[model samples]
Target: MKNYFKFKVLPYLLYLLINFLYFTNKKVFHHPKLKDDEAFIFVAWHGDLVSQPLNYFNKRPNGTVKTMISQSKDGEIITKVYSLFGIGAIRGSSSKGATKALISTIKEIKSGSDVAISPDGPRGPRHSFAGGVISIAQKSGAKIVILSSKPTKYWQFNSWDRFVLPKPFGRVDFYMSEPLDVTNLEFEEARDFVRNKMLLNIVS
Candidate 1:
């Protein structure tokens, strides 16, 4: 039953869900500095993921958004869902196989693939930044672009990160900050700076 659901049912359901959300919601893009082929690390808070992924996939179909997902049962389901949209996933998390995932992310960025990360994801201290993203930016020479979304109306889950689900036909404001160059900053400083910038643009 688990195999059947994972391989068959889950992907189809997510495909429908993502398409439904994309077609119904009104999206406003704020990516002036981004180019057609330039690679960058996309960062957003985990709580806003319910809508952000779909928005990014629909809005930026020309760019690939590869993200780090954990190597766990839930991650399996999430990865399957992502594949339906042509998004790529690197399996690992801060707790397990994180080093490998980080290396893969850097390589992907250097190779011209855009990467997306929820700096406070897979579990969260809720908007607190993680150092891995900054490290990727510094090493890969990819600018970090902060993304945030606010749905005019939505549901909030009881989960640790207060996961959100925007209502169908509602308006979602998607904000993308100017690209940030983290090469010169120290690890801790870069993390804090990015976190504050994301917080200001993304509604919790």
Candidate 2:
């Protein structure tokens, strides 16, 4: 019963919830353009995943957006939800089969597909940066863009990452930082630069 609901019922509910929130809420976009054929990596905090996919796909419906999700139960639900939304999901995590996932993501990016990742997710210290994104950007020669969304009114779950749930009819403010070129920077430097930029955009 639990698995049925989680893998089936819950995804549809979330699909409806996201569609409602997306259509009803006032959405703000910043730095919305990316070359149609250029591949880029979007890095966002886990808390904003609820709305980020809708925001990205709605604007770039023709572009392919693939996200890295964990191999856990929650990831399964999220993968199903994303599929319903016409997005792609690669199941893995920083702690589990991340290398294979990263390799696959790099190939996708190299093929001119956009990829999204939550640097601090699947059990996070919250808002921290991981080097995996940097590796992907470097290897794939894709620019990294920091994305975030803030709602005027919302619920904050008391989970490890303090997950966010935007209220119906609320306004959501989306922020996108200037794209950073990670291909030239050393691994640590690229990671730090992205972390700071994401923190600043998301918080400010």
Predicted candidate 1 versus true structure: per-residue lDDT over 13-115, tens digit per residue: 8778767875798877765557768898888788886566665665577778898888988788878888777779998878889999999998898888999
- Specify the poorest-scoring 10-residue window by lDDT in model 2: 195-204
Q: What's the CA RMSD of model 1 in angstroms? A: 1.7
lDDT measured at residue 20 in model 1 versus the true structure, 0 to 100: 84
Query: Top TM-score: which candidate number?
Result: 2
Clashing pairs in 2: none
Off by over 4 Å in 1: none
TM-score of each: 0.92, 0.95
| Candidate 1, poorest ten consecutive residues by summed lDDT | 50-59
Candidate 2 lDDT tens digits, 1-204: 988887889999989988887788898777656677787898889987887876776567787889999999889999999998788998888989899999999989988889999999888889877778998988888898778888887888888788888888878888776678978888898888888888764532
Q: Residue 132's C-alpha lDDT in candidate 1?
A: 87
The models' CA-based lDDT, in order, is 0.81, 0.84
Error of 1 at 167 (Å): 0.6
Q: Output the lDDT of residue 86, model 1.
A: 77
How many clashes in each structure? 0, 0
